[model samples]
Target: MLSVRAYVPADEARWDAVVAQSRNGTFLHRRAYMDYHSHRYVDASLMVEDDGEPVAVLPANREGDSVASHAGLTYGGLVASRGLRAEATLEAFERIGEHYRGEGIRRFVYKPVPHVFHAAAAEEDLYALHRLGASLVRRDLSSVLSPRERPAMNTMRRRAIARARAAGVAMRVGTDMAPFHALLASVLERHGAVPTHSTAELTLLRSHFPGQIVLHEAHRGDELLAGVVVYDFGHTVHTQYLAASAAGRACGALSLLLAELVGGVYAQRPHFSFGISTEDEGRVLNPGLVAQKESFGARAVVHDRYEWVL
Candidate 1:
């Protein structure tokens, strides 16, 4: 029999272990990452067991009458061990439904781990959601590059990188996040927005997963021109945040940094994600932003949202 229960503080180690061993889980799903901004949500994460052995975990949180896959994450979903199969996944979902219904939650929001992030094919929960009559509510388009079969970098991107190199733009993998965060804040300020995480939060996160969370920067004659923070998931590396200064844009510092990442540093990785180019729950696509990503030989992959009334 399959069973589900609310995750407690005592379950931290076990929860992290399951994520480390799961086919679809990344370091992002670990409690260490999830709890960094705990004050923002009421965690409703679940642990699933089969005959008393932990089999799966769902990273989620409660919001009024509904429960959603944790909002702080890029993608949250069922992270299952290698041994889990389709039938058991369905049972797990059924048990999850029962547990939440008992808690007075009237709706469930889900976002399955994107296929590129999976260490193996782990879409049993998607099938389970379909069986449960879930509605496909949103789809955000992200650009991803497959290193092994990627297209050549477009001419415009190449020229930009060349310009940066000619301007003596240097790429550094470093620990000082403040400079980059400052540049990021300035870029977002023009759009009347802000970064999702503060420098302190990022520093804390880096402390938790030192090797997985990395900062790469572009500099020219002591000036911090551009930077990107990447979350490395072994098989894949995702650009969690990227920003460029005005000088950086003029000299193509951002392009240079990305080129080094996709072609020099992380070229051996299976995938490199440039993140989403859509907004307003996926209704709007930022054409210029996506075009820039595509210039680096990246193509479309989707992050989806699904909902079902309980």
Candidate 2:
């Protein structure tokens, strides 16, 4: 028998345990990450059990009349154990629909983890979503590099790195977010935009996930010229934020820093991600941004969302 229950504070250990075992889970799906934004969303996350043993966890929240698989986070879905069978998964989703329907919830918005993050073979949820008649709602194009393939860096990137080296720019890895955040804020402000995370918020996340969150900066001696905030998610090292100062751009400091990350820092990783180059549910693509990422041997990977009536 399968049962779905609402998540409680006491479920923290069990919840994290399931996430740790799930083939598709990342640090972003854990309670430590999701609850950091507890003030903003009405949490409705669920834990599914089979015969009193935990089988999966759904990190989600209630927004108005619909339940979203975590609106605050980048992606969320059913974090099912590696051993969980497909039929069982599909059935558990049916139970989930009933559970929410009983609560008067009419809709479900799901964001599945992309295959690139899977520890083993995953994607039973994709099949279940299809079975449930889930509709595609949003998609964002991310630039990803398969380092295992040892993709060739474009000539333009090689020239840029040569310039950065000649300019004496160096890459440094540290826990410090202060300088990088300032550079990020400055760059974003010029575009009349803002970073999704504040300095304090990012610092808090880093504190909670010290091993997973890292800051890499391109510096010329004491001056910080360019930087990228990387999230280490097992198979993938994701560039969550990247920015460069005018001087950094002119001297190609970012180019050098990225080359360092790709060739040395995260060389062993199967994939490297340059976060989405689209806005408004992928309706708008930023040509300049896409071109810049593509120049580094990165190609498109879609982050998608689905919806279903409960």
Best by lDDT: 1
Candidate 2 colliding pairs: none
- Minimum summed lDDT over a 10-residue window in model 1 is located at 145-154
**After superposition, candidate 2 runs with Cα above 4 Å error:** none
lDDT (Cα, tens digit) per residue for candidate 1, span 1-310? 8999999999999998899999999999999999999999999999999887789999999999999996778889999999899999999999999999999999999989999999999999999999999999999999999876655899999999999999999999867888889889999999999999999999999999999999999999788999999999999999999999999999999999998888888888999999999999999999999999999999999999999899
* C-alpha local distance difference test of each model: 0.93, 0.91
Pairs clashing within candidate 1: none
Worst 10 residues of 2 by lDDT: 170-179
